[model samples]
Target chain A: MIVLSSVSKWYPNGARPALIDVSVEIGAGEFVFLVGPSGSGKSTLLRLLLREERATSGQVVVAGRDVARIADRRVPQLRRIVGCVFQDFRLLPNRTVAANVAFALDVVGRPRHVVRSVVPEVLELVGLGEKADRYPDELSGGEQQRVAIARAFVGRPRVLLADEPTGNLDPATSIEIMSLLDAVHRAGTTVIMATHNASLVDAMRRRVLELGDGALIRDEADGRYDQTVPQPLSPSATLPPVVPPPLVMLPPAVPAPRGVPAPTALPARPAGQAPDAERSPWATPTRSGPVG
Target chain B: MGDTDAQWPGRLMRPGPLASLLWTGLRRNLAMTGAVIVTVTICLAMLGAGLLLRAQVHTIDGFLLDQIEVVVDLSDGITPAERSALEAEMRRDPLIAGVRYETKKQVYERFRRDFRGSPDVVAGVGPEDLPAALRLTLADPRASRDIAVTYTGLDGVEAVRDQRALLDPLYRFLDAFTVGAFTLAAVQALASFALIYTMIRISAHARRRETAIMKLVGASNATIRAPFVLESAVAGLAGGLLVAGVLVAAKVFLVDGKFARQTMFPLFGWAAVWESAVVVLAAGVLAAAVMASIALRRHLRV
Candidate 1:
């Protein structure tokens, strides 16, 4: 399980904050999607989960430990437990597919006997078992990404974070890659994906969290992909338009930390409905009767 | 990881990252390796020459000292019995290796033999004013000063002389030649070390990418450098052995030539060359080992 409270992040020497006043939680075996536009703090949120950046305030707990307080030397252990697949697909170009995966095992000083068995099994898991002897240049982009994912999941990390795993693949190949992530998630790995693909998110029917201007604006259960200018919601609709999955509902609608919109205490919206367009984009989905 | 250097001697011998990386560098740069082998071979050849010359000079000095004779002329008041007794006392001294009596007549005959074919100016009269002498050999040449000091004023002696002074100038020249050879060998050895280090450094620079990758992959620095150090060391030792063999063979075949019998050139025998070769080869191996070990220390980073 991962937990964060009052986690605000900022880049070094940058005036604008990347993420402000974010408090959220993700339970074990939960698939959470962090969705935002190009500059929305999606990658920064993922980077926080990976401890690539420390919180400016408060604490971050990942896999039952306070990751924010851990030493830099022990960070690799955290990385070992939390598998990260980067966009660039960092694999040694000179090695074969098998060798590339074997490198991961080798870095942690796995025995040769163990490496012999684990390499082929993980390759098979990613459907690259037969292409083990081929070099990276011989494989297509999809295959190479599969190899990267295989490398990430070889040790079966507790949390899997894939950032843009299918940014360059075709639609079908993207579906295939998402299926692989789903398989890994089903095997009890908590998967957090940051992507712009709506069809994959809608088809999977997973929870989604949307960010705007580096703040948690709309978080919904069984959410839909709409070009919704986020406004207020009332008690009229039968099925409310669900926001993204697993949002720790927004706080007061004030200036939130990290440039996020502070959510005020408000009434919950109904399901399978449209987003209210009359209120400001930063307002909550519904307004309660009065202020406290 | 904290205190590896505090370990025992056996642990010290284990290949460190620096040595291992040097080993790889040595293997990758075969041209430099070939150059090292040739340079070491030349060095070993020069060392062997110096050794053989030193040994040959020592043996010739030994032969010359053996021929050096001490002359003791009796005073006017001394009798034949006193002279005989004095000779016996000198022979009984444990420091003497051997002593041979020579009358004035024998000295003249020996001089004629040494200076044969010299013209006597239209007459057959041979110059015969050579000294009466007792040829002496000491267990140690250093004791000659003591023997000369003790025997100078004894009875039955006109004059007791240690004539090794005549050979002093020749000895000094030989000493200079030996010193020059020793200096040359040392200087050349230093040059060889610098040459080998530069060669290994160039090799490392050429293949630095391979080493960096290995380091990132968690290979220890020792595993990377072992090949280069071993390669250069083997080449150096091989060169030493080769030069040693060549010198020994040359001594056996060339020194037995007819010109060696005509006399001025003091060619060394095979045994002399063999003994000297062993010493030279030892020196060469030591030099190579030092160069190999040092090259690794300076170059291997990963």
Candidate 2:
């Protein structure tokens, strides 16, 4: 679980604060979409959760520990339980997919047998099992992101924070990457992804936390991309539907193995449930309570 | 997690991704690594040679000191009683190992025999022209100063000279050379350190992305730094070993073989050579490790 209570962050020598009194609570196994325009504090929030930056005047508690209060030596232990995926797909260009996946386990001192077994299993889960011998440059953009996701999930972190994982991918490839994240989420890993992709947020219909001017603007249980100005969900609006595999068919997403979120999808929304114009862009003040 | 933690030390020691990272880094930057090794080896060799030279010079200084003596020339007007008294005073002092008296006739005969090749000069010299002298061997060469001061203004003494006065300039020259060698070695060592620092800094900069990825994946600072540290230490150790080989080769070919006909102390004894080699190796590794660490702390965030 992650909790941010009135977190405000200001960079040194900066004219404006990056995040202003932002507070939110995200439960385990729930995939959260962090949507905002550039400089709107999307990345800053994720960085705070990762303990990359301490909150200026508030508490950031992750996995039951106050991140800012923890000693630096315990950072590795904290990070081990939190996986991060970046927009650039930061895989070692020189290493093969298998080695790249194995690196995550190796640094934490995993044995040869465990690394050997876990690497291929995770690779196969990400659909890169056959391409394990290929280098990062040799793979497609989608495939490289797969390798990254494989690396992040190989350690079986309780929380996965993805910052613009699809920023560099095309529409089709972005869909594929989103599906992979969805698959990882279904396996019970709490995923908090930051992106400018309005359509994916609209399509996923997951929990959406919107930020504007570094403050919490909206939070919805089953949110959509309409909070900001509406945009097309994808390049091809009328593209044919693709049925992703069920969660059982994918690898287990063990949500802490402590039974946090219910291991069941709330079901995908039926098409044409509500027209875009009929839904209010901003939450009604009466219904939109103050953030915790 | 428990299993991994328990086996961390063993896994760390074993060759894995870190070892491969070290190998790849070295191989890709072979020229830089080679430069570091060569520079460090030359520095260490210079330092070793400087130390050996100092040791040899000290041995020669000791030998020369052992042969030193004080010469006291007696006045022509001195009475036989005064001469006997001066000789007795010299013999009574504990600092004097032995004293020998040479009369005027005896001195003249000895000088004629020594200068027989120069017959004209020897023929011009008379028995009165040569003064009688007392040759005094010191029990301790360092006591020459006290003996010279005591006997200089004595009634029978015309002049008192210690042999050390003549050898002082040569000793001073050798001492200066030793200091110069060490200074040059220190400068070369600084150059070697600069090369190592630059090498590590460049490599760390080049690998910044990889290091960032490692950090994101929960790799500790030690984990990220281990490969770089090991790489430098390995290079330093290789350089140190090369220095040892060069010294041994020099000992075998130059000192023992080429200078075999001369009666001199060995340039550096085997025990001293090995001891110096060990010290050099340890210093090289330590210096490299420290340089790598400092560079990493400044350049690499992880």
Candidate 3:
């Protein structure tokens, strides 16, 4: 289970907050869609859910632990419990599909015996059991996404959040991917996906939340993706923290070099001199020895 | 899954956690790792060669310092009895090794022999013009005071000059060069480390997509870094082993070989080259491992 209460996020340079006083809950075996338009904090919320971004204020609890209180060192453990499918799929192009799936186990120091049995099993679950030997580059988009999904579910993580997973897939391929996710949700995995695709979300009829300019604008039990018109409440009410100076750019200046003369002298003071003269060309400067 | 596939990679590679990391990492960066191994081997070979050459030079330097005799010059016309007494006195000094007298004629003969094949003007010098001298070898060069007190006022000598003055400076220069070789080797070793680090970083960055996936999948830090560090260390090992072999071969066929034996000063311990290579290998590999560890910290960030 994942829970957020009064969560707010503000970026260092952002004009407005990414998340503003948002609260939500996701339970086990539930298929939820975090639907929003562009710049609507869907990605930010996802990042916050993964604890990749910390909330400026409020609590984020996932899988029986307050993830907001987790130190950076212990974040990996939190990540292990919550498998994430990135929008870009982030497949390691260097590893074979089987090795990529096995990587999840390898990092936690699972023995080779467990890896050999598990890697193929997960690949089969993702429908790439036969293509385990292929590299990420050798696979198609849907195939690569499947590899990513396979990698995430290989550990049987309690929670899964996929960001824009079906955004790049065709209509037919999108349904196929959704079915796999639905299958995972049925098997007791709490799944949350953020996507702009309306047909897929409407077809699933799951719980949905809508965001606009970082605010939780709507919540519906069986919501369909729709274009929500913006209503600017008070654009100029908040004062700007710092005003920018007008630009009048100029070219950079170049500096000139100073010429220095070279110093020339023989190696050992030409072989004979007083006892307190320079001894060697490289010798340190102290009047204790002579060179001739 | 078959049992052999499960156990074979582990057994064949003889991998602990680190070895398994190394094996998997090498597989990932196979080309760069291969290149690093070759490069490290060559660099280590050069370092070993320089070290072995320097070792031989040190042995010869020691021998040279032991042999050059200090010449004591007293006022002319010493009697035979005084000379015998001086020899006996010097023999009693702890620093004195041996003493020999050179009469005017002996000096003339030695000069004639040394310059025998010189141009015509040098060959006609007479024995009467030569000065009588005493040749003294000391157990320690710094024990120059033995001659300072014993031969300074003795008859038939004018000046007592330390012969080591000429050769000591030469040895000092050689010593500096040997130190320079070590410094140069250290710098090159550092460069090799940087090269390995850069290779790992580039390879890691290029395959960062995979690494991110690996991280999300719950891979351990050691499992990810082991392969790259192993690849870097392999460079050092290759360098060490090659250098060791080169030194041993040079010793057998070059140093203790015919020309070296026939030379004015013979070099001892021809086997030291290969032995030294083992040390070089250890040092280089250790250095490479350190570099990889530091680089991995930055590159393997979750």
Candidate 4:
């Protein structure tokens, strides 16, 4: 769960703020699509949630903790609960697929047995169990993204943020990657994916939060990619219909494996209830009411 | 979940994975690692050699300073009373440690024995040709110049000579040599630090993707930096061991086997060698580790 009340981020020498007066809330077990053009603050919003960049003025709370105000030393602790994937599929070229996945756990100081046991299971979950010994260069683009997903999901994080994860893949490969993400979402991890793929966004029919020129333009439940573009004559007429692959069914609600500290699940906030301002000591006090 | 949370500190305490990471990093960058080790070894060798040479110079200085004395030669027409009075005067002087009088025959005989290899030169000299003098040893060798200047135009004195004057030029040359050695060592140390910095920067650049992934996966800054720092530390340790080997070999071969046997001057012993080696080792390791840390901090932000 995340809450951003009046979040505004500005680059020091920039002429305009990257994000301005944007406020949004995401509840637990929700899959949200962040749709925007380049420089529209989609990636910037995700970065704010990760605390990679501080909001100039805001209370960016993730799972009941104000991420912007957490100590620098505890940033890693926050990251352990919120995993991330990127468009480039940032895997170490020299490491094997299994080592690459295990690296995520290793950096968090997981024990050898846990890495040994959990890496294979996660790789299996991503359908890369047969290519465990293959290097990143040896894998196909979709497979590489699957490795990245397995690594992000291996930590059993509560929230997964992806920034254009399928940008580098073919349309068909992108669909497979989306299916993998859909399975991850089905397993109870909150997924906030930022993407430009209208077809996938339309096919998925999930909640859409659109940004334009650093402002939150729309928040729609079960929304299309764009309201301006006319809908197709038929839902599946313009492009190939997006569908989950038949073989890649992620085990439903996979429990936390040994050695990974299971994320403390926060209770989903009820609609119309105000966010608790007392928990965020560093938040600006100018606005107190919930954003409509 | 609570049990796993309680185990976090204990699990992090085990450096087993980190140690492997360090080893793998070193192995992956073998050429750079070897280059760093060689650089450190050469620099530390120069530093250790300079220190040992300074120690040897100090030892020889002490030995030679203790032998310093002033000689007062008597005039040809001086009476025995004049010679005895001059001897008594020197004995009573606070600066004079001891006074021995040599007669003309004794002086001539000693000159003959010193030039025994050159019989032709000895044949030209006679007992009456040499001057009788009082060899005046000083309480402090540094006072030789003052004593020589004091007795230069005294009664019954033909000329006064200070042995310290003869050795001053040699001491100056040795002092300059010591300073030159240390300066060269310092330059080499600077070069070593620069090489280490460059090596760490290159390694960090090469592993930037891996490091970025590590950071994304919640690795601490220390965790990301540990392998690079440990790689440099391993090279430093190797270089220090090589320096110790070089110093020990220098002591055994150059100091004891060659200089001690070939020259009458006293050379420093093993204790000095070990002390210099330890200092060089510490300096080499400390510099390498510090340079690596600085390079990582500047070039790689975890």
Best by the lDDT measure: 4
lDDT of 4 by residue, A16-115 (tens): 6677666667777788999989888898899898888899887798977999888987888788778899888878787899989988888878878888
Q: Order the candidate numbers by lDDT, best to worst.
A: 4, 2, 3, 1
Weakest 10 consecutive residues, lDDT, candidate 2 chain B? Answer: B1-10
Candidate with top TM-score is 2
Candidate 2 global TM-score: 0.75
Output DockQ, candidate 2.
0.18
* Location of the lowest summed lDDT over 10 successive residues in candidate 3 chain A: A244-253
TM-score of chain A of 2: 0.78
lDDT of 1 by residue, B23-77 (tens): 5455666677777777788777877777776777777667655665555555646
DockQ ranking from best candidate downward: 4, 2, 3, 1
Cα lDDT tens digits for candidate 3, A1-292: 6666767777654556677666666665667888878777888887776777799887788876787888765666667777888656666666789977777766666677877898898888879999999998998888888988988887777788898888778888888888888877876788889998899988887777667666555555566676233222111111132421100010111321111111121112233332232122224434532311
Superposed model 4: Cα runs more than 4 Å off: A12-15, A63-65, A70-74, A170-176, A182-188, A198-205, A227-292, B1-7, B10-39, B62-165
Chain A TM-score relative to the true structure, per candidate: 0.79, 0.78, 0.76, 0.78
Better of 1 and 3 by TM-score: 3
Model 3 per-residue lDDT tens digits across residues B276-296: 876787877887788889888
lDDT of 4 by residue, B1-302 (tens): 11122125422413776777777778867888998898888888878878987887778657766776687888888888988888888888899999988888888888999899999999998889888988888887778888988788888999998878887876687778778778877887788778878878767765666777777878877788878887888888899899899899988888788878887778898789889989988887788888899888787776
Taking the tens digit of each residue's C-alpha lDDT, what string does model 2 give over B21-124?
Answer: 88888987789999999888888787777766676666665665567789898998999999989999889999999998888888888889989999999989
- Ranking 1 against 4 by DockQ, winner: 4
Angstrom error of the Cα, residue A142, model 4: value is 2.6
TM-score of candidate 3 versus the correct structure, residues matched by position: 0.67
- Which of the two candidates, 1 or 4, achieves a greater TM-score against the reference? 4
Residue A284 C-alpha lDDT in model 3: 47
